[model samples]
Target: MQNLTPQTILKEKFGYDNFRTGQLDVIEKVLAHKHALAIMPTGGGKSITYQLPAMLFDGITLVISPLISLMKDQVDGLDAMGIDATFLNSTLSGQVQAQRMSDLRSGYYKMLYVSPERLEISSFFDFIQQLPIELVAIDEAHVMSQWGHDFRPSYLNILPLLAKIPGNPAVLGLTATATDRVRQNLQQLLGVADEDTILTGFARDNLALKIAHNVDKRQYVQEYLRENKDQSGIIYAATRKQVDELYEFLNKKGVKAGHYHAGLPERERQAMQEAFLFDEVQVMVATNAFGMGINKPNVRFVIHYSVPGNIEAYYQEIGRAGRDGLPAEAVLLYAPQDIHLQEFFVQKSEGTEEHKQNEYNKIREMNAFANTQSCLPRYLLGYFGEIVDHDCGHCSNCLDSREMVDVTTDSQRVLANVVRMNQSFGKAMVAKVLKGSQDATVKKYDYLMKLPTYGLMKDRTLKDLSSFIDYLTADGYLRIEGGEFPVLKVTEIGARVLKGQLVVEKRVNRRVIAQQKVTSAAKGLKLSESDNKLFAELKSKRLELAREAGIPPFLIFSDKTLMNMAILRPQTDEEFLAISGVGEKKFDIYHKEFADVIVKQH
Candidate 1:
């Protein structure tokens, strides 16, 4: 362990009793000048892993990180605690960046974060060598692997460049997601000794996971938001296009909403982010880009619009919620197509077959969570090597009805239909045949010949069948050979199920009601009758207030302000603040007129 006191520094600055799980050990190792790898889950106090020790240790701790947003967020948080911290990144103007770097060199800061690409710049490297480099913290060190979720080609080149620095700073690698393979890769890449590496098994006990299967996912999401309107939350879409579309839809439905995605222009993305941070917007519909390093303590829920590629991605995404640890929700609106799509995404990742196989194992882990009869959190923790007691009584599968069925025959029938139908049928078509929907397409294809199978599954809607198919795909029993139209191919599991050799137990789908719009039922006062009442009230008040404030009415309040005041009919100063155009300055100036009119109205 590193010498000196984390307690003293933690108490003085952060006002905390102690560090959370896995923080103190990593901090100690770093201060001792030993190379270390810290693999803790998101919201697991990962920043404190390096940051606390940076304050206690000798010399400037140069922290390498991704995400300019996260850097600014952390720096701002540090600044709030009366710590002197600054970051150097693309967001800073060159002139500003140079001055900040000069300050860092001249003993102005104990910790500084620069991007990996910044490390390779020869001038930056030379200047760093001249400075007193005590420790180096690599944030999101898993990006070193192209196989890792957030691969950065630049990060792959950082290790050799760090070696060129006059003295290698004690290396501390930090990430929220890493298994044995990821941890091993991290150690080898950072050149850390095995004994120096620290692992806090991933376990988020606060989050309550729920799976809404075979339901209209969009409708389910709408209801969850409507029911939990008092609390702010995030709904993560899988694509930028989905983010934009959902944002527009929520705005039309009258939710105070904004979106964050890399696809937007930088200005728009930042504005949306700032809006959410400032609480100017109630809900932020976003892609994965939005949650990388956000530290909003009051996020009440996180809804995934789609399943993530693997458990690591799932854990990291849901970990964004309930950071204040107040029993927040992590809901997955899963269906059959979702797994196929995820598998297709995995198959498309840029890696060798060996690398693809590695991703396959990760995906299999995620699927196990989705299809498991055990507790969701328990399963999740076990995947990360943590021991969890019995069912959490919080996950969807945990609270769900457990009427397990012998679905071997059902699975085999679906598999045969896909095989018999030329192996190129779309999900809807496969589902329609199974449900005996007898849609024109199903009748056109003579799917009746395969009747005994999917035909009996008809009472269960295609949505239900689709959910089952998703599980089958995730488990590798059914392959979605991605092409123009992804065709389902039977795997060895599917073939075994056909022969009544494999038994698969699944929970029947749940019925869900779509959310109704939670908008104000009353229409606004009409502009026609509204304008006369507004004008008369404003003119009368202006005359009376003119006698009091002894100023002309126009200077006291603008016409727009008067119009809004009349429309809202605010009964008090607090209510007056609710008027659209009445900021503090205008309210103070024109208080008497508005107050008198409001008082007289009753």
Candidate 2:
């Protein structure tokens, strides 16, 4: 036992040859009894950092997580690896909870998972008072910061819980999303030093981010579904109504789909989630309420049916795809009207004025992400404080072959009109005025109709002109102010463009093109057509195993591992153990079954 090392444990228990970019460093910090904050991208193997340490330490590791689904998935995964792990949450009955508590007192589990809300219970606190907890891992640590997008008041209980723990366990905070401000707040709260904070980066190389600016979302989704018929994906909408409508539309199209939202009954939601996870459903149409702790590794795409309220939420939502390290697509459908729903949410939210303003700023940034012509991943990375100079070369903006047209004159017309109208009107009125509408609202402001800026872009339709105004706002030439009753105002940069000091260029025919099929980077290791067939056979065997075990298929073995088996065709026990994601226990339990299939296939 004294000879055990993290590297040795990585290969023997987790069956990986090496650590990911940030895993080893974070593990080393926590092993040295320092509080470490790990900010790696989703699917960058975060759990291994703590899971490995739990195996080395003599005492139990207490994990504080916010999502019950996440805790369940992880506990199941660990149990499948022949590790002792259990979670106590609302899902269990009082008898079952008491039984688990008794086992925990007897040191039956090496890792214990619970929510911060559970820590507030006096009975749970009393049970923990005597346990020898050597390490405490806080998942979704960003929830502790007020500035984070998903701040929860219950998360404040974590600090007090840590203080009450007996052994002064080394703390490890894990989060995939955090800005500079949120990161600073986390460091202060967790007492992690600057040197111990590990940020591998927020960019996911396998995700191709794209935005469909002002398109028929239903038509686009229909066409996309037809193109990628066999793949699993998720579609996110801004509201429950949109989720139901989109689900109905897909169902009518003869799509195998399920819908989930907070409004649904608990059992129905769980059933829908299980259907998606068990591979009975190909698509899950849901709001942001879904996908937080879901560990489905084969989700090939994520489409935002409507824009999300902030970049953090948008980025985290897309991070759900490509968790298996496979290539995935993230498409956001941007309609100018979608901004209103987000704005309504912001105005009705309870917060300090500064927090509301920050949220408004985030909305503007999310809007910009949808409309900007720059590299999509670059824009997202920059928002999270990771600056990269190179364009990702695969995003929608980079691959666009359309001609560029100078829209400086059209932009000048719009910015000049905002100034001429005293900057008091919203986007619709400005577009109406520019298109020379003779409606009562336009007529009531008699001076607005008489201005030279009126009828300036009469050749374009009101919808086209309004979309162009949104483009101007997205590109930073114009700004929208006054939250609910937003008024268009010329920004400093817009002032320069209006003064003819700067020029604007836009793609002539702006549209969302269908994403071309991209081979997973893992597949670049090479799998022949026959290899694909064998991979399918192995996947069937995995599904059978998972069903027998009553767990999600990925927990049995990820798609990436199956692909490796197909390509490698491991023929012996040692060879099978050499496969990535094949730990000693997994090799013991299922190696011969997979090996028999490989032999029969050949």
Candidate 3:
């Protein structure tokens, strides 16, 4: 408890002589009891904001988190730092929970992670009141707002409970995403006084954000999975079904994907997260719940399967990568339908009518960006009111798009085909008619008799046509004539353009590359001369260790483990565990062998 200063903690435990950009300043203010709301970027050391003080303080620090897997991951990280940490939740049985409550009373843990609702229990409150509570940290505090992408009703109860605490514990609310509105809400509702809010602007210059098109996103991700091959990563999707589908697809494609979402059973979620942390699962397909407090420092890529709701949401999701200060890729695959995905959440919001109205307005603002003619990165940065120093030149809008051509003639043919088909056709069927493809609908229209622009538009793919149609809707050139999935109706603008009265263009459409065929660790890893020797030795030792532990060989170590062994050449048991893939099971078995090999100098 004596080393509360960020300086001492960083030097002593973490062996770091200095703090990164805003770390020292934020930690200093936090220790000085500033009720701070920090908007640090992803890869920023957000955890250290609370952790330094938690280590320096007298009583147990309680971290209120949204996800249980996050709790365990952070606990594991803190434990690695040699700090006492534990997580309490429904995952703990009544007996185990009772025992942990006793441990908390005995001050056995320096920090504890508990769900917001679990802490709301009267008995839990009584126990909490008994403890020497030092700090109350809220990870992902933006979620309390009804407008936040990952809102939780349980988070609302924290305000009242913090009020009742005998000691109004110094509060630290950390999130990677927060608008001026959400930030203001956290300040007022969470007792974070206006002056106390630390607005460390969200800007990570280290990350190269790119949006790629034409490649199948699944295939694109597969290529990323193959090329980066051994690096740690997470792929985010908007839906649980996407999470499940992407998880299976990635696995089928050969990436060891750990599918994680709130819908999974607690045990299953924990097991999958543990596998990821242990490096048994090289990639995770998850909703946002899989991140928040999970601290894996060397993650090299964060792929978004759909457009995240806003820049704040986008920054937080992508922030999970490049945390280790290495070059990392943040690939976002945004199809035209993605804007609707977040829009769905906006329309489904539950709160005061005023709150819902505010959320709806934000959703509309977000839509404007989705349909903007400016740089995509600039549009994202502009949302947070930050001016981009230069056009990033890395986003899809910059790389994938060409100048939109006057597709008036193309639109005429598309519209004519739709009109000829009684306006009953989807965009795909209509597109085929323009390309002169004699498919079911094109033949049904056998209206090849009227192949307007047929074969003239063969260069355009369905995706290209979709993008044109999408922008037409956004640009007020055309409207979906019906409800969701409506047939297109050329608008007054479209008619004007068709008649050559007006001229316009939009960004050319692009497609996401699906990940390439999944290649396995054994398939892609060609061990160098030294690496092959190290792998053989590591594998032999691992097999022996697994037999002794009576577990599967892979249960002891993975290909990633052997790979790390070849790269790091650790000289001690302590150092061996510090390598990314070496977990408890492996360390227990192959530590001496790996260390002996590292020291062998062969």
Candidate 4:
């Protein structure tokens, strides 16, 4: 091992002047031979934590990753930087795998990537014993937890693999999203204590989180794509059928798009992934299986075609956008019925009764997030055990200028109806009874018909009553029990509302809350006309250079770098190097090309 610090290695090899937040600390712990569990947001430079240590260690570092594509991307990136890295996965031929294993035993590589399932093979485990493994890094560590949103059974095999390695190499667990419960589970599984675990804040200020309720989703998405034609993004659907339909719609409309689902042949899926990564396609319509290991840095937006089953899934999916530190958007087009689809999935999923109930609770929280009027970022942070002292002005709730109206009367009526029915029914039945439906179920219960609170909301439409009921439930005025059949019940908070001791207010028309005009791409930038023209010119130049280099545009220079170049009008090599992301390697290659553009314009 070389006597070099992480800072020296980072500058000499990676060309980055400084470490991002929480990176140096985690790297220090690992270098000290202590275990670490890092929970960082996407694009948080997590790979460097282990990669840096691998360079400084005397022996090889084995990285157990969750996805083949992710490992390929990382290895390719490392190779581009002239670093020695390789991966062992199903994609490799048997002869090639043998050669790589031979190289591993010969100590020809510094880092090796393999799937957790590979560790379960007796022959593979024995083969690895020939090499000195100094560190074992587990990526997407949350999968080790059975309660996590993305649970993989094969991940549990890693524990035995560690025990077989000689000298007991240090361990590092890395993940992008984990709630407090999942975090604890990860710590326990990885044998790391509380102090060794570092949680970087989940706030992504550059991402504008917006939820569009009850809109014509197809029309809305079409319009959005039309406006953002030059940008790259992902549109995530809830089902494979939806993915195929949206892909067809976009293709018929002449949008540069591709679709992906598990049903597609492996070759076709690989083709689609490469097309999107190379910018041959501007939009990728996929199911949730698409983004676990995607390292595309310049994705400008992510649109959820439907609400995901849990907040953790939603957060991780949206984290794919704004990775280049440029402003991006996360738009969720939701309807009340999306929850039913997720509930059906939970019921069908094979798990214990407690696991199913946990899924149900997470689904309820997801529903609340979709309908929340509070700050979206605040709610997400609180869900992950972080307390933000103020609202994040970037989300839809903070941007909304609508007024709140008192709904105390409606709340009291809903609570009274729940009580009068003796809290034995569900939301649909309560809504039906409140709206005075003459259906057989309502008519069969004579006592429900005789209650004074029955038909109290007859003047309102069922849709409107249902909306208010959802609002009350989300606001804690009511609670729903979990099971195959959920029963509606009044909490102490609901009783207080019924007794007039508490007042409730909510946005008047929940559907119309997000009806304001969709924000223009340049709304928040506050750029002048000349700056906007310069930005366009710089972006065109970036595209031209990217084509010549045969790499993603962001790899050459991020959108944020171009934006800074446009605004600052760097006139010399030194000035260009001063811009963020313009390190020595990039400055040496394209400084003059960018400087000439700026100087000519100025």
Candidate 5:
């Protein structure tokens, strides 16, 4: 026990040979009784930092999780590794929770997972104080900051609860999607110094991000599902009604699908989630409610059926895919009207004026992500404060092979119109003024109709003009201000463009470019015919083992591991143990069964 280090624990327990990026650094800091905030990408092995330290420490490690399903998945995964961990949440019956608490008093578990809301209960708080708590790990730590996309009032109770704990346990905060603002707020609130922040960058290289602007979403989704029938994915819609409609549409097309949203009954939601997790359903059409606690590592894709309110939410949701370090796709189906729903949400939010305005800014940012023709991953990573100099050649934009045209003349027209209108009107009105529409609103303002910039782009349709305006705002040539009737203001860069000091270029409208067939094979491993057959057989066998063990198939073996096994064809215990995900426990339990299949195939 004294000689075991984090690396050995990682291999012995988690079955991985290396510490991914910042994992070891964070673990060393926590083990030294220091406070740290780790902002790694999703699937970047963040849990290993705290989970491994919890194994080394003599006392219990309390993990403050935000969702019940996440806790269940973590505890189950740990149990699969032959570790002692349990979760206490409202999902359990009163009698069961009481028994678990009684066991907790006896030091029966090494790690106890609970939501921050559980700490607010007087009795549970008193009970936990008596435990020998060594470290506190906060998952989804961004929710504590108002600047974060998902702010919860319940998270405010965490610091007070920790202050009352007897041992003054070291605190570790982990989040996959935190902007620089969110990170600063978290660091200040957690009393973690600037230098102690461990950010391994926010880039998922295996995800091929695509934005299909103005395409028939229903048609595109149907084609995508039909082509990738073997892969599992999640389709995120903005509303319960959309989820139901998309689910029904896919069902009508003979696709086995499930739908989940807050409107569904509790049991129905649970059943749907279980179906998706067990691989009985390959697709889950859900609203935002479905994914936070989801730990399904083999999810091959995550398609945004509609635009999200912010980049953080979008990034976090897309991060759900390709968690196993295998290639995945994140296709965002965006349309001009899709942004209206998000705008309505911002206007209807219960936050203060400042908060609401900030939300509006985020909506514009998300819109930019969808509208910009630049590298998709670079735009996403830039929003999170990591500046990657080169283009990610894998995104839709980089792969579009369309010719670039100078839009500097068109840009100056829009920027000049914003100034001509005194920058007091929204995008719709500005586009109307630029296109020289004879609408009553424009006709009523005689001065507007007589502006020098009016009818400057009369050759372009309103839709094209509107899209171009969005591109301008997204690329920082213009800014959207205020909440409800947000007006466009020209940026400093826009001024430069107007003064002929800068030139702008954009890809020709996608309608002019011939569309290529989007396929998952381009992003994932290209397997030979025999290897593909072997991989399918391995998956079937893994599913059988998972069902027998009452766990998800990924807990038995990830798709990536199975794919690697198919390619490597490990036929001996030593060879199987040399595989990437194979640990002693996994090798002891299922190595012989997997090796037998590989031997039989050869």
Candidate 6:
């Protein structure tokens, strides 16, 4: 544990020559025995921050993880790298737990991953006091914040557990997605200072963010899978029924796929996870419960079968794909009506009124994101408080070649109606009044018919008017007051638009276009026929080696690594080592097998 820097640990153990952004800084903070709060996107190398420190520290690092699958995946990955790591969770038998506890007492492990609930046992706290724990790393730290998208009441126990420990150990809180408020909450709860919170940009340039509105999602997904058959991907539905239906549809269509949801038995879920991780299945259809702790790096696409609960959940879910810094697609199939499902969930969620209101606000933002005409990446980044001067140039909005039409007249009509209603109504009421609805609610206020703005937009459908209201609200022209039933009110900007002081423009989806097909490999890496053949051969070899070694294929070699091998045609051990991801350890294990493939091709 002495004289070991993060750089050497990364190279010798993890087979990487350089650290991704924000990793080294977090590692340095941990090494210096300082508390750190790191907000890195998924696949941004968060585990390495504390893992490297664990290697360099004289005592063990205790990781507070939320999910058993996540803990197992991390521990398995570390064990594969020749690092000593173990997880204690409900999955272990009593005997196994006792053995792990005994090992902890004897100082036999460098890292231990556990759930926060485990800390509630006073005896376990006593056991921890005996261990020389140098650091306590909290993964998915956002869950500790009740304001976060994913809130777990159990996570609140972490601070109490740390308090019981003998000495104040360095604390590292990590999450893939956290807003300024959530970050502040974590900082306060973990006792980390503002300066110690490190946030890398949330933008993932390699992910092509697209929102496909008003399309036959099933057909679109089928076509996408057919186009990218050789690649691995995940399709996330919002319910167990949808997961089953999608899984059945794909299976009937002859796609090698599997389904996962909470409804499935524990064994079945684990099998499905292992199947997907081992590349035995090319596509996974699952609910939101399926992917929190998965570490598969070669997923080429992630299609949201339905809109997620919030932007934070959406970003974190899509972050699962393209972990290897390769081009990937995150296509969200959105329908305006689909929002009802989320609203229903929010209403049914176990939380206070304020929590529900916060969730509703987040859902509104997510809905705006789906319908935004601006660059998807820019909108998402802005939501997370990151300002980008330019369009991401890769998302659906930026890539869309459609023309934006001036909707000032329509905007004025909507804003004027809100004013006529005295700004005390909701979006539905405004839309209904504008569309000249004779419904009882609209008729209840007989004065509505007398208003000049009433029936002014009768020629427009209610759906279109509703969408416009949504746009106006999101564009800062209008605001929705929070409550059981929100009232749409005009902001200063809306007042200006109503007074003809400002103009508005929005993208109109004139007609739906076919989704663009991207390659399975990294974008822009076109290989010739011979090179393609060599690439396939190398991939087959890599998969075979992965199976023989009982590990995930990406662990053996990422798709990027295999592509480099095919392109570089590295024929010797030394030549292979020059390729990225091929360090001395990997070279010692895989060079002969992969190099022979290249040499034979030559």
Sorted on TM-score, highest at the top, how do the candidates line up? Answer: 5, 6, 4, 2, 1, 3
The 10-residue segment with the lowest total lDDT in model 2: 510-519
| Per-prediction TM-score to the true structure, in the order listed | 0.72, 0.80, 0.66, 0.83, 0.84, 0.84
Better of 3 and 4 by TM-score: 4
What tens-digit string does per-residue lDDT give for candidate 4 at 286-397? Answer: 9998988788999999999999999999999999999999999999998988889999998998988998888898888888788878899888989889999999887988
lDDT of residue 126 for candidate 4: 88
Clashes of each: 2, 0, 24, 0, 0, 0
Report the C-alpha lDDT of model 5 over 472-576, residue by residue, as the tens digit. 988999988887789999999999999999999988733232111011222355789998999999999999999999999999988877887887676455556
C-alpha RMSD by candidate, in order = 19.0, 21.2, 20.4, 19.2, 20.3, 20.3
Could you tell me which 10 consecutive residues in candidate 6 have the lowest summed lDDT? 511-520
How many steric overlaps does candidate 4 have?
0
**Per-residue alpha-carbon lDDT of model 3 for 556-596, expressed as tens digits?**
66877677667556655555656656677857855776678
Model 6 TM-score relative to the real fold: 0.84
lDDT of 3 at 552: 89
lDDT of 6 at 153: 89
Candidates sorted on lDDT, descending: 5, 2, 4, 6, 1, 3
Q: Quantify all predictions' global Cα lDDT against the true fold.
A: 0.75, 0.88, 0.72, 0.87, 0.88, 0.87
Write one digit per residue (lDDT tens) for candidate 2, span 1-602.
Answer: 47899999999889999999989999999888789999988778888989999998888999988878668778988998888999999999999999998898898999999999998888888888888898999998998998898998888766977877887889999998999999999999999999999999998999998888778899999999999999999999999999999999899999999999999998898889999999999999999999886888899999999999999999988998999988999999988788888988999999888788888878877887788887899988998999999999999999988758788988999999999999999889999999999999999999999999999887678988877887898778888786556789999999999888998998863211101001222436677899999999999999999999999999989998888888877666655776668889998898889989999999
Tens-place lDDT digits, model 6, residues 312-384: 9999999999998899999999987678899888888787898999988888888878877788888899988
The regions of model 5 sitting more than 4 angstroms off are 509-602
